[model samples]
Target: MRRASSLIAYAIACCLGWPAQAQDYPAHPIRIIVPTQAGGVSDILSRTFANKVQNATGATVVVENRTGANGVLAADYVAKSTPDGYTVYLGFQGTQSVLPHVEPKLPYDPTRDFAPVVLLATGPAVLVVHPSMPARSVKELVELAKAKPGAYSYASAGFGTTHHLAAEMFKLAAGVDLTGVTYRGAAPANQDVIAGHVPIEFDNLGLAVNNIRSGAVRPLAITAKDRSPLLPDVPTMAEAGYPSVIAQSWFAFFVPAKTPRPAIDWLNRQANEVFSDPAMRDQFLRQGLVLPLGSPEFLGQHVAEETQRWGEVIRKAKITLPN
Candidate 1:
């Protein structure tokens, strides 16, 4: 009878302790995993957010770069981790939405394997061309490409990358046959475009801004519905008559699917607090990331919608990666 009473007491204690465990989240160091290399936009964003979280809560937060298989490796690591919220994923649109449609046999299901925390930000791509190219505007570039089908080749980060998909969208929308020259990543692709080896390319606004400002590449159009304040002069793809070619890269935070709701709530509250600061908001704006801060539900809904959108694009473009 005494042993039974003790067992009942222990069960009650465990039930009561659940809330405490959730409240004491980050009792240890939290690690934010970036799927790309250090110094890229993902790396910088993760580090900045980590620093903010650390400063705000006195938590020992750290950012780690687990680069491989175009973010699949890092994502898989986070998906399989213990659902304690210590291991966080800094996921972006490409890996979370686009990859599912492209990779035939993904190790982890993006929509199923993770729980959404928050939608961080979104940045659009810019259509750029070599300075010496006669095509100045989006129309002129389309005219040139249409005039000589398959004659012009654009540089892309890789086969299934955002820029590559943008180029494919452009091809479908403009009825042009511009060849795609694939590079390992955006830096080398942008380098080739700047060197005039490739005449045209679509690149991220943040990474393409400095080169555009320096006149290394001429800006033609932005793949957004509205113009960015940083490049007010640049017209939108819709304005340029290609309303169908809008593509924006987004970033968000996610934890493993079974992570406790309290931990997710705490992380969401922290991110919303840190990023909603006006100074921080303006800082991201200047860097070309438009914050879309909201509840975890918002992130989940947005990811679902984006997954559908990108899946359609991938199907139309027939994009696939090797298993």
Candidate 2:
């Protein structure tokens, strides 16, 4: 009888301690994992957010880069990590939305293996062409491509990247035929375009800003709903007569599934606080990013919708990865 009474007391104590433990979460340093090589947009964004988190919480936040298999390595690492809120992921559209449709046998299920924490920011891509191409605007480019199908080629970061998909979308929307050239990364792809080897390409504005300003590459249209302040002269894709080609890359925060709800809520509150600051919003804007605020559930819904949208596009374009 005494042993039974002691067992009941212990169970009640555990139930009470959970909330207290969650309230005192982050008693130690936290790590944010970036699923790409250092110096890329993902790495830069992760580091910047980590700094803000550290400033707000006074906790040591470390940003770690684990690049391989197009962000699969770092994502899988975080997915299988302990659900203690100490380890988090800075997931992007490619890993969370595009990979599942392209890689038939992805090791980790993006939807099932991770829980959404917050949506960070989104950035649009710019349709840039080498100055030697002679087509100065989006309409002229489409007309030129229609006149000489397959004569012009476009470059992208890789076969199944957002850059590649955006170009494919443009081809379908404009009813033009242009060959696609794949590169190991965006830097090389952009370099080849700047060198005039590749006539055209779609790249993130942040990556192509300097080149655009330097007159190395000409910006025709931005794949966004509205024109960006950085390039006030560039028109939106919709205004360029290709409303269906709109695409924007997004970043968000995630933790391993089954993480305590209180911990997730705490993390979400911290993120909202950091991004709500005027300075942080301006910093992101200066980097060509637009911050969109939302709760965790909102992020999950957004991911689901994006995955469905991209899946349809991939199917129509017949995009797939080799085994």
Candidate 3:
């Protein structure tokens, strides 16, 4: 009886030690690696998360930008970091899925090297046209582009980025040809769009929403089956008669692979809490995000499904890019 009692006590202690030990998680400052440039969506959103994390965990959270190679540089660094939960990467859909599809030689496999913490938010891609363009709706834009293939130039935040892939997918689905012009980031590219230097752009709602409200740019369609709350009147890609062209981009959280499960759980819970917070939700809205929260397992499956979906698009299109 004494031996059995000891064994039971040891089992209970082992289970209790997990999260109790995790209390030491951010013993020092935590570093969040943002895979894009300093001003992009991931950068802004991650910084907001980091600030709230600092308040919740009582540890300073720093955002480090490691740009280039379409976010592979940041992925490689974080994947190689210690699994002590001090380092994490903000994984964007394009950087994780579409870039690998287009470039074909990403340094680290997203599924292999990282563990998802939580799904932060999803930003549906929006098709916006310059005021100078005659198109007022998705069908009209398609008709015009079909009428003059390659005559209308559309700006992309980056080459083979989610926006670019979405545009390609739409073109494939709509059977239209519009030339793509790649830019360093959405802000500048969006600026050009608003200025009418580019005839059209496939942008995330964050960049295009306010401009759209101000009538600086014309919204053609949302890349989703249903209209977005931010743009309720704008028709969905499906409603525009191209249901298959719909695609919504998202951002996810990840720590280096092999981070303890308890730590991952804690982080995910903290993230869900943040997402549920009214202040944080409002903050995300101000930044043009519609915050959607989910568990680590949910985020993992989402990344897996998104990766597979992008793979299907690439395989069907047989997409290739130059170095």
Candidate 4:
């Protein structure tokens, strides 16, 4: 009986030592999983966060790209990971807000399966067309599309991505019929647009800014309430006469549900601090993104509101994806 008690105590102690306690959290290296290819916005931001966190706390931080199903694969992986703080997910509006409504049978619920950490940044998409295209302004593009319904196609990063939804919203609000050409990612979609394989795309401003400035693509209007400073000459959709076509992309951090409150709070504080720096803020603004620092509760509430907002867009646009 004494031996049995000793073995039991040993097992309990080993379990406790595995991750240490929430107070001594991050006893082990933490891994942040991103749902996009490396060199993309998501991957770049995730790596930046990891590097900053490691620098600030001297804790090992790893960023892994687990791409598939337009972020569902990585998100589901993080959802099923240990509830310990070791595994983190950098999820964007598509995975957290839009996918919930688009894919009813998603393996994990964004709200139910993960605990909110922080909302990192947000930005709008730039409405761009190939340089060869005659359209120079949003009005001209609408006129051209109206003249030839279904003759023009726009590149989408994926079926249910922000790129896709933004195009759909434009179609609905502008009363045009432009077919969508889906690509594996924004990089390839923008590449094809630049290559003239596709004439139109609503691309992330960060990704489209260089091409827009290089004259590889013509900037029509941005899908934002205010014109981006990076391309201040470009008008907003509202200013272009489509007040209902506002769409923006946002990114946030989350961990598997049931992670200790202390770990969540620690991560939230660290991320907010890293992004709130003036240098960091200016860096993101130069890239056409805005850093938003807020508590975990703010992220949670934002997710809920965005889900509902996108749900209406999905329903109205009648969007569906293939299995």
In the range 204-254, model 1's lDDT, one tens digit per residue, is 898899999999999999998899998999999999999988888888999
- Candidate 4 residue-wise lDDT, 71-170, digit = tens: 8999999999999889999999878888788676899988889999999999999899998999989899999999999999999988877789899999
For residues 163-196, write the lDDT of model 3, one tens digit per residue. 7878888888988887888897777888888888
- The lDDT of each candidate is 0.89, 0.88, 0.82, 0.89
Each candidate structure's count of clashing pairs: 0, 0, 0, 0
**How many residue pairs in model 2 have overlapping backbones?**
0
Q: In terms of TM-score, how similar is model 1 to the real structure?
A: 0.92
Q: How close is every model to the real structure, measured as TM-score? A: 0.92, 0.92, 0.87, 0.87
TM-score between candidate 2 and the true structure: 0.92
Model 2: residue 230 alpha-carbon error in angstroms: 0.6
Candidate 1 segments whose C-alpha is farther than 4 A from its true place? 1-17
Least accurate 10 contiguous residues by lDDT in model 3: 283-292
Model 4: per-residue Cα lDDT at residue 228: 85
